[model samples]
Target: MPRRKKTFLCGHQGYGQICHRCDQTRTQREKADHARAEKKQKKQEWEAAFAQDPIDLRDLPDHVVVKARSIIAGLMTNTNYRDFGGKRLRHNRFIISIPVTRNYRMLCRDCGSFLVPEEVLSHEEYNVCKPGG
Candidate 1:
């Protein structure tokens, strides 16, 4: 079988004479620019017809930060010091409200036995996890 000969366009080894197609595409792109702006303006007009909810930063509750830390701590058990949001958390950085509550699913500091939340030894008692006080 004869090996097919390769062709070049506009001196381009990949698509030699196809440079005319590239020029045609460029011309079409410029022609579409005006329509693109019109479409953008129409989209803005449609969006302006609706009302968006505004974030009330001052309305944030005090428990939000602590609750967030607790949730993140739970995530840390599986994730390596990384929060559920993919943010790296420092060892000492977290909510300190959750006391050593006995958790039936939690393991002991020395032993791998599960204890209740109220019975689970917290950082203050077992010095195991230092996430919360």
Candidate 2:
């Protein structure tokens, strides 16, 4: 004998005991909800991490933030600023500029023995902040 399609209360016809169409849609919606929740959790974690940083890196791009953190870690370990291709600002000898990326720079203050991270700025911002750009 052959099986027959039956209409479920959802008004969907299928061979199964439950309406496969509604079930599929429900499953997809659950999966999407799960994914959205996961993404939100990750975003929260990312935001929380900024509190631990010595400088405010919230406005920088992801890659620039990572690079700046690495440089900050290196500086904390007594690494030489020159090793990171950093140079003292011509106008302000106490201020050191480290290249976080081609378009971004991390400024630090020379605190006698170690460097204190100040801020991360884009090329345009850096230029504008200089005495003569």
Candidate 3:
């Protein structure tokens, strides 16, 4: 008896003596081995990272979403956002533009003089004197 020459298409194992010709069995095994190795490598990398506690936000990728002073500076000059009425309220990540003023005229019931709206927003209290008194 003599040891025979053998070629392996898959795994480390060699086919038996009668396996000299090619067959589907060899191809299937080789494909399976390749898929298994890929799966194992992915699993090892995943486990190595996932085993530790996740990083906090402070340890996240260094990205400055916004420099605070720069943002404040931008906001300071962004007055065009104000409505024609001179009022602005932001809510829900949206600018809520409510009319700060509308056409309004006021007459002194006592003095018969007209008063502007700007004076009204600041007065807090008013006592218009009558002409006769």
Candidate 4:
């Protein structure tokens, strides 16, 4: 058999090669993969924690719903939405609105008007334009 060539940390007893370099590269790759997996897990956990539930108007208390109804009622009386503003009612408009993927508005079937739960609009006329009774 020929004399063995000088070899590095890899432990291969054949041709000239560095031994520990392969091990170091493998360890580095494993560390990178572990960090990536950790990042993905953290993102999934955050999404689960902050996920929103569907809105149901009926489930809300009477007091929470009253102002929204009144705002819609006021809009029917020829008042501009901007003028008939209530911060609290507008903030909670999601309660009355049917949840849609993209467009989130209370549609009135009677007059074919889109209504914002928080504001009054003379043109939208939610009272006259009754939707689903």
User: Of the candidates shown, which would achieve the greatest TM-score relative to the real structure?
Assistant: 2
Candidate 3 colliding pairs: none
Candidates ranked by TM-score, best first?
2, 4, 3, 1
RMSD of 3: 21.7
For this target, which candidate reaches the highest lDDT against the unseen true structure?
A: 2
Q: Tell me the tens digit of each residue's lDDT in model 1 across 1-133.
A: 6544445554533333356656787899988997899999987864553222121112223344234335434634543322233221233222222321232112212112221112223334345554334
Q: Write the per-residue lDDT of candidate 4 for residues 70-123, one digit (tens) a residue.
A: 545565674444554322223333223332112223332223353344322222
lDDT of 2 by residue, 1-133 (tens): 7999999998889997799999999999999999999999999998999999999999999999989999999999999999999999988899999999999999999989999999999999998888222
Candidate scoring better on lDDT of 1 and 4: 4
Better of 1 and 3 by lDDT: 1
Q: Give the TM-score of candidate 4.
A: 0.30
Can you tell me which runs of candidate 2 are displaced by over 4 Å?
A: 131-133
Worst 10 residues of 2 by lDDT: 124-133
lDDT for residue 16 in candidate 2, whole number 0-100: 75
Q: Model 4 Cα displacement at 77 (Å)?
A: 38
Model 4 lDDT, full chain set: 0.44
| Shift of residue 56 alpha carbon in model 4, Å | 12
- Stretches of candidate 4 off by over 4 Å are 1-18, 52-133
RMSD of each: 16.4, 2.6, 21.7, 13.6
When 2 and 4 are scored with TM-score, the better candidate is: 2
- Could you tell me every candidate's TM-score relative to the true structure? 0.21, 0.82, 0.24, 0.30
RMSD of 2: 2.6
**C-alpha displacement of 101 in model 3, angstroms?**
44
